[model samples]
Target chain A: MANDKSSMQLVANGILKENPIFRLALSMCPAVGISTTVMNGFMLGVAVLFVQVCSSLTISMVKKVIHPRIRIPTYTLTIATWVTVIDMVLAAYMPEAYAKMGIFVKLIVAFAIITMRLEMFACKEPVGASFWDGLGMGLGFMIGMMTIGLVRELLGSGAILGYDVLGFKPLLFFILPSAGFFVVGLMMAFFNYIELYYKRKKGFKS
Target chain B: MKNIITIIIRLTLSCLLAAFVMGIFFVMTSKAKKHNEHVNEEKVMYSLLGYKVGAPVPETVKLYAVYRYIVTDPAGKSIGYLVPTGQGAETGFSFIILDLDGKLIEQKPVTVTADDAAEAESRDKAIKAALGAGKEAVYADDKTIIVTDNGARTAYLLSGKFAGFKASISVMLALKTDFGIRGLAIVEHEEDPGLGAEIEKGYFKNQFIGKSFATLKTLDVVKEPLPDAYAKAMEGVKGEDGGKILEQYKDHAIYALTGATISSRAVTNGVKGTVAKFAYRINILDNVLKEQHIVVPF
Candidate 1:
């Protein structure tokens, strides 16, 4: 809204500045459930990205016609359409992955990030800008999810992306829900530290 | 009127748009989603009865749905009904396919949940306690062993058809002997956020590996009447600490839980009930086999 941020900036911001899980912490449902494995985390991230991008474009194109009272439902309908499509496609072609991801694939309908972008950015923006914003945010979510999943998988399971790495005896506790909080907190703290260092040294403000 | 018309038009347009997109989406993904569901059902089926499953599963078998059919002998006479029953708890449910012939099936324990709340709560607590003590691994302690959990407020029996069902009664058989603990789901009387709640701790339930029904009856922990013949039969099995104590009584008669005797007895009875049910049917089948002079694995 301030500078009509360019597509490149939006993309970079999603990766670092306004990350869905690490920075803004939006779309947590799948983040918690599918972060058990790196492959699951990546697959879920891509699914979210697909839904987010499609919903954003649709919402932007119809922004002028949608009334305020009906806008929320309109956006949800759009998101759910994309989610069902992705869910069905995954289930058909990649049954094993679909099983591993389970209900989280269908849960993208309620992922706040999709609707949030539609309301806060896409509704007021042009189609191109809205598309970029959605893409960036989705990628940011992917990054955050992948980071957490990588750490958890590596420590809790001694694997990364289904490949055995480090071969450390897993701390079984890390795989459970309680350890989820611990892993996410440490990652967020680490992100904050990096952000602070960059800001202090380079005067970075995006 | 114009303002109202605009609102109505906007609402209608959005709804229509949503429906259109959703319809297209469904059309595109329907086949794949159905396929995925089919595969999952197949996986569950494979886990349940692979040995009996002919080399290739028939494409027509719908894994998600439970169907009842009659099981017939090779001679084409009906022997029993194959009933697929599913039971659910708060966490999840399991589907069990049972073959039943009359009174024998009625006596069989089909892994039912507790209708009573008190038993459920205590059983849950016990599971938590045993798991919290870093005892997740369990092994076969001995045949006909009696495992009593003072903390669990329940008891369990290991061996026989009783091992097939899931519930508090399952605590005794679910024990991972290698780890020396009962699985977290079966134990009752576990504490919250304490040693008991740690499902991974693996302690009290693990102690049963070397002990047996005969050993339990003779120990200071319990005082119950068990046949000496049963004791003699179980005398050779050893407990984890490495002694003939467990082996000697591995296959002894029934073992009883002492402090939480009711819970223990329930598990024992539940197991015995399960075995009786299965054995009765098997025996009937055995008799049939003998009459036919047919040799097959029982």
Candidate 2:
């Protein structure tokens, strides 16, 4: 406890250093499914943001009572409850969008990333730190998925967020689920390249 | 005891704050959302009328009056009223507009935002086919003039333009009725992106051209005969006993999709149902007030 990092450090770590999708490779279920469209990706990001912030703060507050044997279930329940609230609100208001992203929204319950964060970071951190950390992680995941959607929309359909970029004739394969894998792989590789460039410039030995 | 109370208060306060913020967000976005929905409804109405005229923005002005004038056949009989109906298709709510005479005015293309890549591609293909076949028409970008459906038949309507993702199919019969579809735009749907979503394709919509109500009712790829009421009406025309009613829909038969029976049926029935409902209203026109007829010059 004496040697622990600051609250700001925890927040920064979640956003970049310990990013949930790119760095830690978690929550791939929704990440892959909703990444097909920018609208779906954006909404799913908001849902994750809500879940991460609420669950992190709850788990931190209840960390003292949670026994090792029951910790995972408790964390999952907390996450699921937050997801359900967002899901209901979306269904009632944005029925069109909610209808399109159905089933995948409900599957937020089994997202292992939320539980992993609760166990690894939130339990030991202060509530304030945990909340910020969770927010950063959720944002990072959102950015990753949205980036993929943006690329797929632009390349596959020749549009980004409905704005046509390339000639109207688009490469149709870019929007397919199989295409998602190729784009993700290339994106992950790009992220690695950026990380390596900064490390090399800083003269860090591997 | 004090610490326990403090923790409970903190949790409650946080939850309440989140809820309050979300509530405020809803209030702020509600008006714009409602306007978007209203615009979509008008687009649906315009698609079925089968004639291409540009749609006005729904948010700025409400459509207080929308009606179809039934054009009888050479025998001088009244047909059904043409009205618009929305249906679930690949991209969202693709529409088929019809009037009482069993004449399909037009089909409106699917309206989509560029967000969903799969829907966009499918919608584009559908619109292209509809226009290329001269089954639909649209207001071309950079040109204020209303181009014929032939303009769309060769090139994509939404080809180079990007703003709001929308597809509309408009049909025009030789009959000189001013009442026609203004647009058909989809609001929402989860049709299989490529294949099942082909309903938005204009070719499927164009097949309804020149289909009479009697024939549409008995519409089968197998070329079945009309149902009892419709056959009787046809017989009345041929027997020289029927006057106005038999001639109204004698030429309009509903067309059926070969592969997508249910989807085609849904659209065909929707057209028939709307026309029937509107015709019923027109029959009791004395009871239906024209809300926009009161012209107040300020």
Candidate 3:
């Protein structure tokens, strides 16, 4: 599926067509859980991006040596190693950011998006292609999180990235976990609508 | 058999390599991580003492840490407290040995090397030596910090922990010499954001300031809506205005957060208990010092 596509197309595909959160519905836990604020979403997004890219690269490079029976364990180990290294480095160098993202950083290992990419794409692709795929998927997830965060933060608290934008909360419910489902569901429908419009324009049947 | 063996060997090697890489990073960053934590702690301590971040702490404003330890017998029965004299000692550690009834037994200084101070084992060894046989000093989780601004006792900082909505919330409070709260900082908590987490907001925390120990003992978390004017003032009032605003509400109980009364009550109760215990403990310590005629530098 990835052989005919150029690297840029692979990235665009991840961002729009096969978007982790919006389209593919992967890693919904964090997308719903931490997307209460733009900063949280952005921070978790950056951490996940770093881990995803590193894990994908490592798996692709070592795929030749890893036994088929043990590839899942190997992939798990690679993801865990990158997450720990990032967690420690952030704690040491960027403590303020770490304070916000610390809990989420460790949880990235359990994220289905990273592991799924490794299994479906990274392990089968060449090193360079796997790197591009990882980057695209990571960026897609980051964008998805930030989009959810933006809507939640603005509506719930009447703030944007912690800055008081509306001076008064429009809907306190938006900040709650329940609101996350509503936003994600509405966003999915909106994206699906756009996709349907484009498909129809290209004379494609539903 | 050969294929299975290869698979096992490959899996083991991959695990080993991952562990090795993680170990390298952990060892390399452990020191820096510790340093960062120490700095963050000091920053919190200083901020609670009304010092601004990024600015150097003034020489005149000194903070002396008084480590408190409960001296226990071999059977784990509590005996007494081994407290530092806080004499501004430049060398060695000076401790005031007190019996269970707060009777002064002896004042002794344990000469511990700089290297030995970092390790708990060596420090325990020194403490054991000073404490004599059959008694051991167990470090208390709470810390009592004396803040002196130009040799005058300005504030007493105490660390306290209380049960919150999800987990224990650790808070550091700075109290005036008269036992009125000067300021407070939430050191750590895992409360739910946008609900119980509002306890960390300045509007919520600043209300505790200027509340005397007497007021604090009886302080309640009121479910009534917080007045808009007072809320705005509590958000960012300073100097005489802030003092006046706080004084006006000095007798007022804490206003519970909209959806976080449990957390709000937790902090109010925690502060009250912490201050009550500190006041009681400090009174005893003061009496001991006065009886012993030991002059605490701060």
Candidate 4:
């Protein structure tokens, strides 16, 4: 109902305010599974971004005709199609990444974050707005995953993007899945703190 | 209601469009994907055979089992078999050990968890204990792959995997016709790219070349630099000390990656298990071949 903001704002909001990982807490499995390294995170994020954008655009353009009762199935099928296309493209052009992430790419068809956006945002918003929202959310997710990957790789393996910098691991826990929760928690807290500080400086409720 | 029918039509139309697009993509990529995997398999086979790029690969027939490739020369003489790759427990593999005439000592299921191979019990010792004496080795299954070439039945290509620092690392080992370790390839791995991933490089794999299963079975991952003796031998100029160094480690040593002890050890354990399994299978094959009066060259 509130569609007054520019497309840029919608995209920005997904990154800063409604980030699927840090803000909304959707699709944590992939966010953690592939976040073992910055490169892994970056690659997965790029993939999700493409699927999310394509699915969102498809859903938004067809919203008027989608019967509410059958909407979930329609959107799911839509996302699966896009994911398949992306997987084929990757296999054709980027054999290395295709090999590394072939399974995960197929799994993206079922990613909750992509589905949730189709249901909640794209169905309600216009096509252009939904496209921006998907892009923003996808970018925000990529950044969040990259952040987790950087910390984990640097501490768990003493490397970043697979390159050794520290010469030794500092904390192995950070790279494991359990520690992934902590990275997300810490980032959430940091962002929340920043928001609260700004709120207080503006004389608003913290 | 008419609304229900309308929704059905919309869903059907959308699905149709999506299917059309995906169908086009499938047509474009399916052939290439299958072909790529086939070429890779051929390459792995040739590398194991030490064949040159343009050299002819023996003709092949399918042997259905856990693994699928069986090779024969142009004259229809037996060459070898190719073991299919698979995940066993957790680490990667598809390998093995032995003398031309020696029977497999035994096969034991070895778990290489950090706890089992941890302090006091050297990882190799723990492995020895697991495999020692009367532990009955499991029969050949999908996890272990062996290629029994007729030229030298003692030789084989064995593959295995292990949990590395970050992810699973898969390796292929080529045993020469004379029971010598020949070529090595890291088929797949998800280790940290630059640091842990060095396992795929020439230097690491080359270590296995010229080494044999007997020596590798007792190998330990030493953290120190290559000793002067071994260093000398490695420099292609073997002095007396270098020969002594080689002698010392010939049956038991591997240098850990500069910063990847965990991954290095994992690879060692995975390869060790594979050799053990291969040796056992070769022994079985040798018995059968002997009854048939087949000769495996030394």
Candidate 5:
């Protein structure tokens, strides 16, 4: 199935056609929980991106050796190992960024997005194809998180990336966790609307 | 059976490989991680002493860490405290043992090797061995820091922790020689962002500054809104003007965060308890030092 599409197409598929956040709706917890500020969203996005790519690549490489019965455990172990290594590296080299992203970095292990990719795409795809798929999905999640964070931070705190843009909070309700569901739902609908618009423009059936 | 055996071997081999890879990274990063932690702690200490980050600490400013241990009998009854005396290399690595009543029991030299000091278990073992059988010196619950500028005592810093909205919040508070608060830094917490997390904001933390031990004893968290003037001053103004605004509210209760009164109260009560305990402990330490006629090297 991967051979039917070029590597670039695979990446685009992950970003648009099967976007992890808005379309597949994988890992919605972090998308809502940590998307209070753009900086948080960006930091967590980078962490997830790194972990996803590394774990996907590792799983694809070792797919043959992993027993079918134990593949799930192996994938979990691989993801956890990468997360720990990345966590330590960030703590040592990027202390300031680490201070902000430390807790979220550890939380990446529990993100269904990374594990789902390994099981569904990486286990069957070639190494290079798996890498591109991971990148695409990671980028998709990052963009989704940043978009949510931008809206929430702007409306909730009247700030963008911590700089005051509106000078006063116009809608403090946007910062609450309940606002997260509304934002995600609206974003999903917006993406679907765009997709439907393009499909109809192409003269495709609904 | 044959297929099962092969699968088990593969799983075992993969697990071993994962462990091996993790072990290499752990070794490569452990030293750098330790160094980073040490530097971060030094930064916290300097900040607590009112030294701004990025500016070099002046040569005249010195910090002395006094490690206090509660020496307990085998039955867990607290018998005394083992406090190290002197500073830097001047330390003969000797500990002055004082009973609960602040009477000096003995001054004994305990050798803590360089390697043993790196690990807590080994270090505890060495200290325990020196104390002989049936006596254990458990480390104190809080940190005691003495800040000196030139030859004069400038401040005393203490670290304490208390339950906040989600988890325990660790804070390091600086106090003037007379026990008035100088500043406070929230070292770590798990409070929610945009709400309980606002406790770390300057406007909230600065409220604790300039509050005397007397004021702290009765300090409470009030639901009353923070005065707009004081809030603006706390967030923007620094130096003398900010001090005046904080002083004006010195007698007032802490202004609770709009949706985080629990966190606000937690920090206020935590600071109050920390100061009260530090005052009592320091008083005992001072009397014991005077009675022993041993000039503290810091």
Candidate 6:
């Protein structure tokens, strides 16, 4: 609404400037926890995607009717309810993937990125716009997770998605919790460097 | 006053709308959910029963919410029951299967007959004593299930929760009727990945597989700094049968998974306690089943 940005820019913002992982640094708990394997990250990412989109759409529709003074609670109620629904629905239907994301499903309620979108974007935007924002954020999260997962799994376990890509284990440290933070920080810095480099180039033209 | 009234109305409306949407989803999924849940259970049962890959689909029995059943390849030839335990220590479940004659093979499914319905009521208390008392349920149905061969229970499929170094670890344990561990699957866990979580991998879990149980009552978690010869000797005996491994391993002590000693001990202790309690429960149930001659005299 402020700049009348295109839908694609909104999507790009989640991946680059407003990335829940890199820029905003939200949902770091899961960002580190599940990135141990691509399979783990993929399953959790899908769960987050489903919850993120649904909650955004619902919150957008109800924003007007909801009291501003109580909007935060309302948003929480909406997100938690959606999370339970996703957990049950997955358990009830998709038994295979649900197996991969056992306890992580319940942990989604604690994700700050999911709630932040509901508060910042979904609250003010129309349902359609909010839906796009949710998709963008979810995709960004998925990319971040996969990037971390790919690096950790490949380096730590010498595998990717359980496939033995390397003949043997490379750097075992990458898979540990301590290395989890290291890899994420390095990736965040790498992405930031790219952003800065591009910005300086753009400034030179101006 | 007017503002407060508007606030109340807004909150109430949102709550109602949320309720309405949730109800629709709940009703939509209720039936399919039940059907899908039994799918994983079906696979786990078959595997534990030693039906090799590509075995024919086993016939299944569903008795209300508390019990699960699977009729093996030959129809009506054998039955397996998933006993849901909401009482006793561990407060999970045990898979009991019986031959047509009601003998405990591996795991059996016994019916609650009208004549023994009253006695069956006491079965919970009796069975609870097997798992000990006051244990909370940790593993859910989806977390684990047990299966035995149609002819005889080849193994006791055990699923229990282990308090790992980080989070609770849910594991499926397959123990042969002879107290040998057939398999161990770390289904869900939150341990440190490269170290503690390696318990999920083959090298660690495979060590316990096919190793006989000296006593289910307790297992020693072999601390690190293991002698080289002992470690290599242990690997050579992986999946080897008999009490030799039990003796060599010292009171059925499970060697800690390399640098993940705490996580290793958690699984070792949890599985040991659960199996011992379950074995005792089966013993109690055996006595109770044997007394059918009295027809409720005791």
TM-score, ranked from best to worst: 5, 3, 6, 4, 1, 2
Q: Candidate 3 residues B152-241, lDDT tens each? A: 988999899989988999999999999999899998887877888889999899899888888888898899999876787888854447
lDDT of 6 by residue, B1-298 (tens): 9889998888787778778877888998888876775556555555545565577645441111223233343334444444543322323444454555656555322333322322334444433343344321122232223342343344466567768897888877777767667766776787776778778765566566655666445557777565444455444545444345435654345668767888888887877776775665555554644553312111
The most accurate candidate by DockQ is 3
Task: Give all candidates' CA lDDT scores.
Answer: 0.55, 0.53, 0.85, 0.70, 0.83, 0.69
Alpha-carbon interface RMSD for all candidates, in angstroms? 5.2, 6.8, 1.0, 3.1, 1.5, 2.3
Estimate the TM-score of every prediction.
Answer: 0.55, 0.51, 0.93, 0.67, 0.93, 0.72
In order of DockQ, best first, we have 3, 5, 6, 4, 1, 2
Rank order (by lDDT, best first): 3, 5, 4, 6, 1, 2
List candidate 1 stretches off by more than 4 Å: A1-3, A203-206, B1-5, B36-66, B69-298
Q: Supply the TM-score of chain A against the true chain A for every candidate structure.
A: 0.93, 0.92, 0.97, 0.95, 0.96, 0.93
Error of 1 at A167 (Å): 3.4
Evaluation by DockQ, superior candidate among 4 and 6:
6
In model 6, what are the clashing residue pairs, if there are any? B81-B109, B96-B107, B96-B108, B97-B107, B97-B108, B98-B108, B105-B153, B106-B153
Q: Write the per-residue lDDT of candidate 4 for residues B1-298, one digit (tens) a residue.
A: 8987887788789889999999999999888876776677668756666776788655441111222112222333221211122232443212122223433322224444433322223534543444456332232223223444442233466667667776777787877655567677888897754356767765455556677767776767888765545555654474757555555655557777766778778887777776777666555555644554432232
Docking class of 4: acceptable
Question: What is the per-residue lDDT of model 6 for residues A1-206, given as tens digits with 9 covering 90 to 100?
Answer: 54376788877877777888888989988888778998888778888888999999988887778888998879877887888888888878887777667678989988999989998899998887888888889888888888899999999989988889897888878887678799899999898888788888889532
Enumerate the chain B TM-scores of all models.
Answer: 0.30, 0.38, 0.87, 0.59, 0.89, 0.57
Error of 5 at B254 (Å): 1.6
Residue A172 shift from truth in candidate 1, angstroms:
2.2
Stretches > 4 Å off in candidate 4: B1-10, B38-170, B189-210, B216-248, B253-298
lDDT (Cα, tens digit) per residue for candidate 5, span A1-206: 65677889988988888888899998988888889999889888888999999999999998888889888889989999999988888888888778766888898989999999999999999999999999998888888899999999998889999999898978878888789889999999998999899999999986
Native-vs-model 3 lDDT?
Answer: 0.85
Residues A1-206 of candidate 3 have per-residue lDDT tens digits of 44777899888888888999998899998888899999999889988989999999999998888888888888899999999999999999999889866888899999999999999999988988888889999999999999999999999989998899899988889988889999999999999999899999999996
Segments in model 5 whose C-alpha atoms lie over 4 Å from true places: B79-82, B86-90, B99-105, B112-126, B236-243
